[model samples]
Target chain A: MKEVTVGIDIGGTNTKFGIVDDAGTVLYQSKLPTQKHADFKDYIQELDSAIKHGLEQTSSDLQITGIGVGAPNANFYRGTIEHAPNLVWKGIIPIVDIMQKDFNVPVIITNDANAAAMGEMIYGNAKSMKDFIVITLGTGLGSGIVANGELIYGFDGFAAELGHVTVNPNGRNCGCGKVGCLETYVSATGIKRTVYKLLADHIEESELRGISFHDLSTKMITESAERGDSVAKAAFEYTGKILGSKLADSVAHTNPEAIFIFGGLSLAGDLIFAPTRKHLEANLMPIYKNKVKVLPSGLQNQSAPILGASSLVVDHLNKKSSVNI
Target chain B: MKEVTVGIDIGGTNTKFGIVDDAGTVLYQSKLPTQKHADFKDYIQELDSAIKHGLEQTSSDLQITGIGVGAPNANFYRGTIEHAPNLVWKGIIPIVDIMQKDFNVPVIITNDANAAAMGEMIYGNAKSMKDFIVITLGTGLGSGIVANGELIYGFDGFAAELGHVTVNPNGRNCGCGKVGCLETYVSATGIKRTVYKLLADHIEESELRGISFHDLSTKMITESAERGDSVAKAAFEYTGKILGSKLADSVAHTNPEAIFIFGGLSLAGDLIFAPTRKHLEANLMPIYKNKVKVLPSGLQNQSAPILGASSLVVDHLNKKSSVNI
Candidate 1:
């Protein structure tokens, strides 16, 4: 009869949900195609079915807490998904109102990057970290900044757009109509471009000899590097160094304890970690030269997002319960 | 009579203390030579004498709430001055213990920058702001970051070291043994150095005619800019532009409501503000562009430190106060 919270992590193409307990244990989990429908209500219908199935799996006596959702362009204060770039939903989606009606409990929503950071704080390797930047190197680079144990939401609840920050003023063109963003050099798209640029400059022979950017993937490159492929290894080493140098400069701004890396491209392991540590140390000020540590997130793949989303519910309920009692 | 808190602000050469009420009204304020003492304990004795004099000025009915101190390298967690580079203190000074024993009340201590940020948040122009950065651009840049209404103290209480963040990578030498730190080109010494560099590069410069780095002061240049001196005006414009670009990058990291400027150099007004605003808006991302406000502190120059120090006591007492009692 353990109480449960339904946590939903919304992606552009897929939506994942899970029932989590007080001790951060996931009792049940499932995923569904998110982009199958044209309108936002169809996605809600699919989400409703998933919640019902999750409730059926638990005992009747098991109490339900609240629902927490993590999505792109989610606003915690307004409780809406405003201008979610990838989703077909044209306007603000009143997610909190709809969720509250179905669950009969509190509903909390926040941007995906923020949710990931909270998840790391609550159930991952960054449990005791107060100031740290969580970087997700996926299709596009996403960052969550935790300062003073709370997420930074700017005046319009749009802070921590680290991907859009110019890393090299004239280096790369980003999808966000910016030049040389951190993501433009660190994301999956970013690395492939770097590989192409490197290929054009170097006469070195490798298995990536004639691979086009369309056929390339981060997983393939990581596997190739694990097999001692030079080009794949170079791709990670160069990417990690660039990211580490910028991160070193960023570290001095807030002097965080450590940096946590997750998502697809970060899984390159030694190829990424070694150069990142080297360049970070090389660029660090004496006060923070060897002090800040960089490490991989410990949250198990799919579980991380859901747990982070669940933490929103836990945080919301905790605030409400504390206020009333 | 109402309760009053004693506020102390310690600088390299001078130490100032004042008795302040809840409204941030300074009843009595005085200063002492800070560098005269050999051992740090001697400084404590001198501060104690000043507090005693102030307490005697008022009746016993005027209850002394607590003492709050703002100094370099002060840590709120440990309540110790850990390696204040400006002071000759050999090791960590136990500041809170001495103050508490004298007044028989609670005492709190934090760094000067954090004190300023809190001062602005509670009583100054930035009172309503939850996210803001306070820059004390004087001998060096001292920044205090407030996000979500709490000052950012990282895992080890060394967060918000914005001065040391590298800007040029190979530009100028800093006291911290780093090159191209933001402090190198934006502080008092920083501005002077930029003027000197510009003088060296220019083939036709007349007004800044024979000024050496040591001979030129930030005030002298600011005065020149006010009177239509091109070189002096150029220095300020360049300084503000660089600062604004850096600020834009900072905004991307943690979008704040506004960035507040204070301390000696910031008094230049429009000379610094205009260029900073122009460049900041130009460099900002679309979501944050033209939205974030930049301003100066509203606390009176003399009372800001005192009230800010007192704020530490208020915040501490509020957090630790009992629920039922």
Candidate 2:
């Protein structure tokens, strides 16, 4: 029988699950509204049923190898999601434990960004690269560090919290109770906040000045930027400036070959990339200047998350098989 | 025959060479004035003679296994020293190749901090730890990062330039042409600058205000602090604050089990440790709060550099023998 692995990407609003082949092809796919089920057990039941349906839709001769999950605050070592603020369910969620009891297959879980890094290494631009970093700009900034051809889990299994690293000592208050976190100034939400701050600072003629913070979206700002709104342009420039400077600092740690930017903000293309690249080089140490590349995700946006989550299972299977050999 | 490795620590002023055993013992030691030789070939010849003399001091039954040399800007991959500003040699020096040709044994070269890290792993407190950081606060702040029991060399051989990481963008100008590098505020030279700045900022009478920047030393500051000098104490506190805060950022990259401080500045004991530890805990992320350790090097001040440099040979021998088996 052909081998297939189950990949799941859990988000605040919805959870995407798919049956994927060894070649990273999604044979079957499904989604569930995460907030619909208040109880953890009910959510597990719905998730299991959806997985079973996906398996049924796929080829009957396919043998299930393992399952891999990517979640907001997931811990690979403990297989638990701990106090993730955006999630519907509160407190530690033993996801791998629940999934394993239901599916009776090998299960692994990690923070979504780490899964993205694994995806980049196994199936994306970093296939041949040993040292690299993957930064995801979504609701908040997330990072995954790969060094010496291995993912750095660190001592706590929660390394690569680049989003929380302070950029300005007194910059902004974060939900993690830190001041000047990179996420506070670099994420999609961060850009919108920047737009309002720019609007207040400069008396520039801009269409975005009237929009409320809740009403403002990254799409609206991107559209405004496309139309050459000064505030929107400044916001992107400011975001990139902060991000690029911090990226230079991260370089001092691992000295990655390239930094791959994935997720929503990355879709802005050169608007974000231009300023980030300029500032990254401007801030780098003389020896590292022009040595590193800032690139976009090679995988399609719709498939990148799923692909990253699936690569986890593929990585596990490869390691397991190698051990047996 | 007894197996031994030659470990050499090459500095701008003096070069320390020693014969060491697998147990991290320095059997025989000698020093050579580095800057006295104007030409690279002259320096090499002098270094070769020093190594030969040290080897002669040992018994004839001793078997030469390998040689490890630690320098200011050594690269393991190229086995060359790059543009190290402090070194007498201006450009790349093929020290490893020259040493190999002379010694006819397995030779390895790495930056002093990397050797210090290897020393910590092989002979010091990190013997059992897989992930830790070694920060040497000597003339400048040098760092060696160990993750998963291996040094992270990145894409280039030049990773772990922690001193160059920006601590305060507007703070101080560094020799690397960067402003606000951590080394600008925390190294032996850094603390001296801090002492001068504090003397200017505060009206509190201190004896150190009379000392010139050229004559000021970390030892004098430590003694002054021991004698209840408020300015010296403030300098230590200020240095710790900047270092601890930046270290908090580094922790986000690799959640190290412990951070070992070695070199001249670390000799201040509680004067440096008390503030660094307090500020480290204060600035840590909530999850990492009080989980990581701030420790002093277990190796003696005189022996640590030599042992760390010697560990290169031990590491090389270990790897070579393992490959054969």
Candidate 3:
């Protein structure tokens, strides 16, 4: 029988789940509004039904293997999601255990970025790479580190937090109660802040000056840069300088074969990537220069998250014996 | 029969070799001046003779297992030392292949910092720890990263060069043709530079003002600090602050359980540790607050390096079958 695994992505607004084959094909998929159920029980009940429905859509010839979940603040070792700010659920939720009780299968849970890394290793560009890093640039920067073919889940099972690494000591005040975080300068929201700073710094006026802070989006900045707005172009340069320099520092720690850029900000193409790549090369130590590849994520937006989440189950199964569930 | 492993530490001035048991006990030890042998062949010949002499002291019951060598710019995969600035050996010297020809055993090689980390794991405070970092504050700041109980040897076999990581972008010029490396502000040489900068900054009457830049030593600064010298004390504080803050950045990448301060500067005890521990806690993100420990290396001066090098052999042996040699 053809083996199929369920990949679940639990986002704050929407939860996307799918039944995927070993070849990374999404056989059946469904979604549920996560915020509608503030109560943990209600959320789990709906999630259980959604997953069951996804399984039912698959043919009888297909054998269900296990379930893999990607959520904010998810812990692979404990299989729990602890105080994830984005999610409605507060405190520590034993998500894997709860899912396992209903599904009776091996339920592996890791943070979203980590799932993306596993997906890259199993089904994306990092299939042959043993050491590589995946950076997700969204509202906040998230990272997943893979070394020696294993996701680095340090002692606490939350090892890779590249965003929180202090890039500037006295630079910007971060929401994490820290100053000058890499995420504060390079992420989607970070670029907006940069645009405002650039607008104030340079006396030359641009189209971005008309837009309010809340109204501004990364897409708007990209459009502005394409239109030859000096302020918007300068913002990308500043952001790339910080990100590329920080990535050079990370290269010293893990020595990744490649650093894959993912998420919305990455979609900006060469506008963001060109500067980042230039600064990364400029800041790198002599030996590391020209060796580490900085590339875009191989997985596409619509299916990448599900693809990554699904690979988590396949990755686990390949390592251990099959669970009865 | 009791099995023993040979641990060799190759330094610029001298080479220290020792026979150690699995229990981390040093049975026999000796040293040779490294720079005397300009030719690589002569150095290996002397090394082989030294090992033979050390083996003669052992009884018939003592069976030699394998040899592990720790040196600058050593590659674990290639078992070669490549372009080590400190050493007289210039190009790639396949030390492991040469030693294996003589000793006929599994001769393993790695950089000294990595050896120190393995030593800490097998014999020091990190025996219980699966994830931790060891920062060696010598002439240059060196680091060994252990995550998931394995040393992070990235794609290039040279991953953990924490010293070269830029702490300040425009801070200080580094020997590696980079600006503001952590080593420039944290090591023995780094502390001396800090003292000089402080002397220039502060006009207060101080004994350090009398000492010329060339006449100064880390030991003298330690003595000056002991005598309640404000300038010397300030240097340690400044160095600790930079080291601690940069260490916080490293923690974001790996989330190590503890960061052990090793080597010469670490000998300053609470003077260095006190400020480093303080700033580390202060700079740590909220979620990581108080979770990571900053401790001193448990192994004292001589035994630590040897113990670490010996552990490399044992570490390799534990994973593989017996070496034919």
Candidate 4:
């Protein structure tokens, strides 16, 4: 029988799942609106049927080895998802325990960023690297730190909250009840905020002048910057400066061989990477200069979340049997 | 036969060596001025003879097992001391290679902070902890990070340089050619700088008014604070605030169970600890608040350096033999 794993990615709007083979290939996939059910139990019940229907559509010889989940505010040690603000669920949810009971297989869970790091190690650019960091630059910045070939769960399993690290002390208010968090200035939303501030501060903008704050998006800013828009360009520059300087502080913490930029803002390519690399080099300690690389994620964009979640199963099975993949 | 190891602590002024048994006992100890010989070879020759003489004074049944050295800028991967400003050695000195050849036993070398971390794991308060941080507060600040029960040597074997992390982008100039490094405002010299700034900023009847910069010392400042000197007290409060806030950033990085303060400044007790703890809690993310303990080093002050260096040998031997001691 061919062995496969069920990979699940839980998001605020939709929940995506797939049957993945050992080679990181998604055999069958489906999605459901996350908030369609008011109760978490009802959501899980619908998810179970959806997954079973997906399995039936796939080739018949496949046997699911385990289930792996990626979600927000996931506690790996407790196998639960704690009060994640973006989620409709109000309290702690024992996702792994409930999934294991239904699937009758080992269930594992971690935050999406950590799962992404594992995917990078198993199938992306960090294959040969034991020490590296992956930064997810979506609506908010998230990070996964891999040192000595293992993810750092810390004492309470909530480690690597890089976005929440204080940047300006009193600069900007964050949703996490903190001020001047790195995410407030570096994520996609952060880039938009910077553009709005630039437009308000300068009158010489060729584009992005009349764009409403709610209507503005990072793609529009990226396109405008590509067309020589001064405000848009300055926004990316300012965002990179903050990210690069803070990355220097992180380099001091773990001294990773490379830092991979993943997710939405990363798609801006040289606009984000160039400034970040330039500032990272400029801000680094003399010994760390010209050594660490800042690179883009190697995983295919469309399948990244599913691939990341699936790789966790392979990693878990290998560890249990003392085998290296 | 009683197996013992030689532990060496190479300081700027002196080099201390001790013959230590398995149970962390010092059988014999001695010291020599580090700058007594100009050439690195001559210094090694003198150290070799000194160690032999000290070994002869110990019990006849003791068998030499290994050697461990702790010094500033020591590299574990390269087994060399690289461009240490405090040491007489100018460039990279292959101390481990030279010593291993001389003694015909396995030799290990790492920075003093990392050695202290190993000592804490083996014989100090972190014995039960797999994840913790040790910050040494002496003439300069140094740090050692432990995660997943292993020291983070990083990709270049120079991880955990927490002292050089920028506190302010435009603040005080650091000896490392950076501005506003944490150590520039938190070490013994850092405290002295703060006290001088306070003296210049305020016009109070103070005992520190007539003292020149060269005549000032952290010990004197501690005494003045105890005697209710406002300048001295403010200095401590300022130092603690910076240290505490930066520590919150570190907690976000590794999520350690505890942070141990070591060396000269830590000897001040509540003068430093109270402010540091207060600010650390005030600045920590809501999830990490009150979860991390900021405690003093559990190792005895006098023997800490020696014991720290000695523990490296025991740790190395255990790793080689696949034993957990």
Q: Which candidate number maximizes TM-score?
A: 3
User: TM-score of the candidate numbered 3?
Assistant: 0.97
Q: Order the candidates by DockQ, highest first — what do you get?
A: 3, 2, 4, 1
Top-scoring candidate (lDDT): 4
Whole-model lDDT values for every prediction:
0.83, 0.88, 0.90, 0.90
Query: Per-residue lDDT for A167-209 in model 1, tens only?
Result: 7776788888778888888988888887888788898887777
Candidate closest to the true structure, highest DockQ: 3
Instruction: Give the residue spans of candidate 2 off by over 4 A.
Output: A88-90, A101-104, A320-325, B317-325
Please give each candidate's TM-score. Answer: 0.96, 0.96, 0.97, 0.97
Docking class of 3: high
Q: What is the TM-score of chain B in candidate 4?
A: 0.97
Question: iRMS for model 1?
Answer: 1.5
| Candidate 4 per-residue lDDT over residues A289-320, each given as its tens digit | 99999999988477788888888888888777
> How many backbone overlaps does candidate 4 show?
0
Better of 1 and 4 by TM-score: 4
Ranking by lDDT: 4, 3, 2, 1
True-vs-predicted CA distance for residue A205, candidate 1, Å: 2.2
Residue B46, model 4: lDDT of: 96
What does candidate 2's lDDT look like per residue over B163-253, in tens digits? 9999878889999998988999999999999998887788999989788999999999999999999999889888888888889988999
lDDT of 3 at B159: 93
What's the C-alpha lDDT at position B181 in model 1? 86
